[model samples]
Target: MMGNTRELPAPQRGDSWNTYECATVLCAVDGCDHGACQSGPFFVVSISLDEDKVATTIMYSSDTGTWSTPASLDLGFIESDISISWMHGVLSGGALHFILMHDDARLGVLKYDLGTSCLSEIEPAFEIQSARFDSHALIAPEDGQLGIARLSGFNLSVYWREVCHDQVATWTKSEVIDLKKHLLASNPMISHTELVGSVERTTIIFATTNIGTYMIDLKSLRSKKLTSELRLFNHPWALFPYFSFYNPDKLRTRSI
Candidate 1:
């Protein structure tokens, strides 16, 4: 499992009005054996937006133990109108994908490539772009490709990014799950549903409803209720799923 020991503080810049956001992604450690703990060589990417709506990016490399020089992010023509979402980013295709919001509405996605240190924009599916922000979530499938899951009323639609022969990327609707028929069968009192979080490299996604929270597997349409007592209310995007594994060998040989 990957391990981190140092606390990475955000780079200081701008005044009190600056909005800062950051995300971390594990890097591939060279020549490392299986079951080894990788503590370094990862990346922490921080993005800051000033009052003028200009965005700047700075990256921290664990190998160098230092932050890179901040560079202005060219958001193209829409730079003045959009802002990056604070929601946890989805790592796919060796890039960190963040949601873009325009005046409280979902615009699309922003892609920050780790290898090239370049930024790009990804247009969301038309159906997804028109839906409410909380109803959809960006996900990374097991194949490490970019994908999205949207919950529209009682149905859940999933889309995967596909590249055509012309090298143009498009979103293909893969499948739809009938949530009302499946979820409402057991609990008929479920009023509203919203997609919250997803497990990276897996088909597992978490959703919240007025009744409870559920963990659903997109492959088999199987679901399990994680909690029923805690209602998320209006904050459907509050849940963030984190996965980690503990090495039993280290635990068994501990000095204490």
Candidate 2:
């Protein structure tokens, strides 16, 4: 019932990294009974990435303890289709966002504010099954921007959008832009996840089954693969993205 919390080791390529100390947690979004524990400012939800039904639910890890109990959600629980569920997403800037598709759930998108841990239904539920939650919920740089990708069966597509302030409604509205093509040319979002939080020189990094881990460096319009020493699976539970940061201050300090 105890989940693991690990930080990604330093990059072997001598890649320079920086630190902006923060805590992280991952959880299973499926209706699984998997427990979760966290060490700092994060929690993880466990869910089955390749199965159907409630029997596949697993444990979630927030910090370093067991989430024997998940705080009850106050909003309406619009049950998604039997073939749909939320297994993977990201936590950043006190906000937790995930892609919610399918007309059955009644809510197409959902974003939870970590500072409040309150759920807010975004838009009318979408009409797709088992889509990538992280792909569509990726936060973009330049601030207030977000990117999303969708995976329907063998088809995969990516999209880019920005969040703008709505004065009359006091809400941020979505505005799609011409950043990248919807990579339907091949399998893209299939079991892919965006890096939670952000690092300098990069907006998102994820690994796909057949196409090694792809780095989405928004700084430059190009994607690169980092060596081949690591092995990644499509399973959400096994997909661990540990980000290591280097700080000159930490190097000078005796204790980190």
Candidate 3:
């Protein structure tokens, strides 16, 4: 039950806190192999969106024990009429990915590049433009590229970003998995399904159905029911994967 007692500094734009979109990530220091350990130097990045479609980012460094100046970028789209969903952001390929949503519809994805300090928009594939925002989940980098998984009815479609030698990038449909064939055999009452979240750098995904929640392995095409009863309070976008690490050698020496 470890926690950070230090509080983050307020955003430079005073009213930015009123927005609902924000993400915090702990990243390993360069050339360090500590793997997210607290003893090693690391960076804590925090980002939030302003009402004017600009994103402000502030970073805290363990080495300096100070927070960096807030960096701002204009998202180049007007969303004053719509609201962004309050959901966890995806970090991949040296950038953070957030969904721009309006009601039940997903307008697009906003990407913030940490190294370059640039903000850009990623359009959804044409085939999935009609799908609701709740049916999609941004996957971590697979084979060095970011991907998105969309659940439409009982079928899940995975798409990957492909870059050509000329530096142009595009999204390509990689594969599709039929959940009906994998899950209906055991839980036949599942009438609706929505993507909840995904594990970083893996094919495992968490999904919710009319019956309950499930942990699915896309690699093996297997589904495991995590809960028997549906949890109505668990909104698809609000759920995130929690990861923890510990040293076994140090743990064994502790007096019980």
Candidate 4:
């Protein structure tokens, strides 16, 4: 709720980032029983408000206009927090790829041939535990990457990397960059994931319970002050602002 913001038209889907895709994240607003939604280039997935059950749709946008009703992707049971990876047409020859990860350990990555409308699972070298794969998700193709930042083992700040190529595999641990103990403490909000952007190069945005809003740069492994504090009203209970990706320049953000 950025107070009485001008009404926005229901978003027509956005253009497909078939080019250099920058990492982007879509998270749930605090306290909405409607679960949350996360979208990648070709897919948008969500879960039941209170159930572990999940559903996903096959979708693509030629321009930043209308989003087709996403086609549901079938699964064994149900789950959430899905991450997708697409081919550059460089290594995989123009195929769309995605990884459906559930907190309960169920994970699968599928490759879809748009021309043929065929889907197949190409298992990875590792089991690819979805839970361990940081809840804070990001898909930044423009910056040449996709990743997430989270507090591993409680306090150490870390992220998972997406390996895109002919060698195709699961996410791998990144070079560990430590956050200052004094400046680093995980927030209690359910949305306690990392929010990063490349105003120049991903200066991450996170609200520290102690310090208010913070900006961290993963490329330089540096952290700095952004704001003294922000008053987020009626934060919708469970909906904390654990951002997966951020680009304040390209879009409008609301802060109450």
Task: Please list the C-alpha lDDT of all candidates, in the order they appear.
Answer: 0.73, 0.37, 0.70, 0.37
lDDT of candidate 2 over 1-256, digit per residue (tens)? 2286454433222322231111234443443222221233435432221223121122234433443232223323444553222334454434554544444432243455644545554442233223433233344333543444443332334444434465222223233322224222233443433332233123554433344444444444344554333334444333444444443444554566
Q: Whose lDDT is greatest here?
A: 1
Provide the TM-score for each candidate, comma-separated.
Answer: 0.82, 0.45, 0.82, 0.43
Q: Where is the poorest 10-residue window by lDDT in model 3?
A: 76-85
- For candidate 3, the C-alpha RMSD (Å) to the true structure equals 3.7
TM-score-best of 1 and 4: 1
> How many Å off is the CA of 188 in candidate 1?
1.6
- How many angstroms is residue 16 displaced in model 4 relative to the true structure, after the best TM-score fit? 24
Candidate 1, which segments miss by more than 4 Å at Cα? Answer: 1-5, 9-18, 25-40, 79-81, 132-134, 234-237, 248-256
Q: How many backbone clashes does candidate 3 have?
A: 0
**Each model's total of backbone clashes:** 0, 32, 0, 25
For candidate 4, give the lDDT of residue 104. 55
How big is the positional error of residue 216 in model 1, measured in Å on the Cα after superposition? Answer: 1.0
Q: Estimate the TM-score for candidate 1.
A: 0.82
Error of 4 at 62 (Å): 9.9
Q: Evaluate residue 45 in candidate 3 and report its C-alpha lDDT on the 0 to 100 scale.
A: 66
**Which one wins by lDDT: 1 or 2?**
1
lDDT of 1 by residue, 1-256 (tens): 2363577755655433235655555655654332445553667787755556666667887777777776676655663367666567887877888777776465688777877777777898887777764477788976878888888787888889987899998889976789987778779998888777788888888888898889899888888888875465656556767665566766755476
